[model samples]
Target: QRDRFQTLAEYYRIKHGSIGPLRSWMDRHWTVSRDKIETSELHRLIVALNFPVIYTTNYDRNLEVAFEIHGVEYVKVANARDVSKARRDVPYIVKFHGDFDDDSSLVLTETDYLDRLSFDSPLDVRFRSDALGSTVLFIGYSLSDLNIRLLLHRLWQTWSRSGYEADRPPSFIFMAHRDPVEEAVLARWGITVVTGDDDDPEKGLLGFLSRLAALVEANPSDPPTLESGGELP
Candidate 1:
């Protein structure tokens, strides 16, 4: 989550303004899977829903590849400028973390995280706007990333504090494996928790998405509205 990214970002800022070295470091230390089913599922769901997705991960280009494999056109956001351009495209994948191909964009390390804290860059405005408008679905994320959590929480608070409707917060989804403890924390902030069997998340997600697509198809004339009355119609 936020803390993990912040830690990586901070480290990247100090090490070389990039996590170029961390790749090697992780390979030497961590025993993690480079192949993730969820990554592929991410692309499948995106194509199924025809929705743009933004990801924040200090990992490889698995997401991008997933899109390509599905024959879904996609664009990567390397900087702020890509945001507007991607917004106009068929489908866009915004990488909040630096991509593997670009070492400099990698936000890893304690210093890098701290530096990004003052996200005074040009992309800040675009990030804020997109976050406000979209229904964000968070998957493969842990609640322990305090920095990321803080950023999200602050964004929600800022929107509310600026005299917007108190109940009209942006929609967010937490695809959970087993209702982690963090679900409550996210719920408090208006994030909906979706728990499915972790071992079969792909199938579960696919089923859920299929039903959602049908619902949208069935209600094309109505323009979906939540009974909870949060999002604007």
Candidate 2:
């Protein structure tokens, strides 16, 4: 049973007897890195190039710590309230699977998933709009997470139903692997999969992004603005 392909949330539940208590315990103890996690270089790159990032991660605040360490302005969107206050100029760090500060806020259960299906909440609309509008670059995630995959597929389905046209911005995945079968499936639903090379995908992506940043900055027009009002509907 332990060797089976069980989700992290399910595995935790089986081992600990309850997801809430387990996640709550982990919120207090779960550490993503032991080697003093930092993102000073990445922060400098974004600040120097004036690039806005909307990083969606399931983990804790290691990324936020990195940004704060370098004094780069950022906002964390937990719910509609937080989204409403987020500044337009700052980068957004959306914790789709919840964060450490709030235990009940964690979206780790089957029920939590069902709640998101409605997409009625302002936070849900805000996230879906950004996800559908921007070229989302997924990092540190395997395509195997069914919950997340379903959420993305639903977004695509919603867009199609809403009459979003071809000229709309396409969503992209920045994965390390380039499995043809998986890429085909993602492509079928409008998500472009961009794979980094075998040796160093991160470096490859960084180089490409560096070039992209230069090009975007070189343009005389105003920077591309992510909707800051945060109002859904």
Which numbered prediction scores highest in lDDT against the true structure? 2
The global C-alpha lDDT for each of the candidates, from Candidate 1 onward, is: 0.60, 0.63
Write down the RMSD of candidate 2 (Cα, Å). 6.9
How does candidate 1 score on lDDT?
A: 0.60
lDDT of 1 at 37: 34
Error of 2 at 211 (Å): 5.4
Per-residue lDDT for 103-199 in model 2, tens only? 5566665556667667666666787777666666555566776656886688778777878647557666666656789888887777777665445
Q: Where is model 1 more than 4 Å wrong at Cα? A: 1-21, 24-42, 84-87, 167-169, 175-184, 197-207, 213-233
TM-score of 1: 0.70
lDDT of each residue in 1-233, candidate 1, tens digit only: 55665565565657685455766665355433345634555556656566655655645666566666677787887666676566565666666766665666666666656677775654556677766766666666666666668766877676768777364544655463645566667666767666553468667666556556666667766535433322212
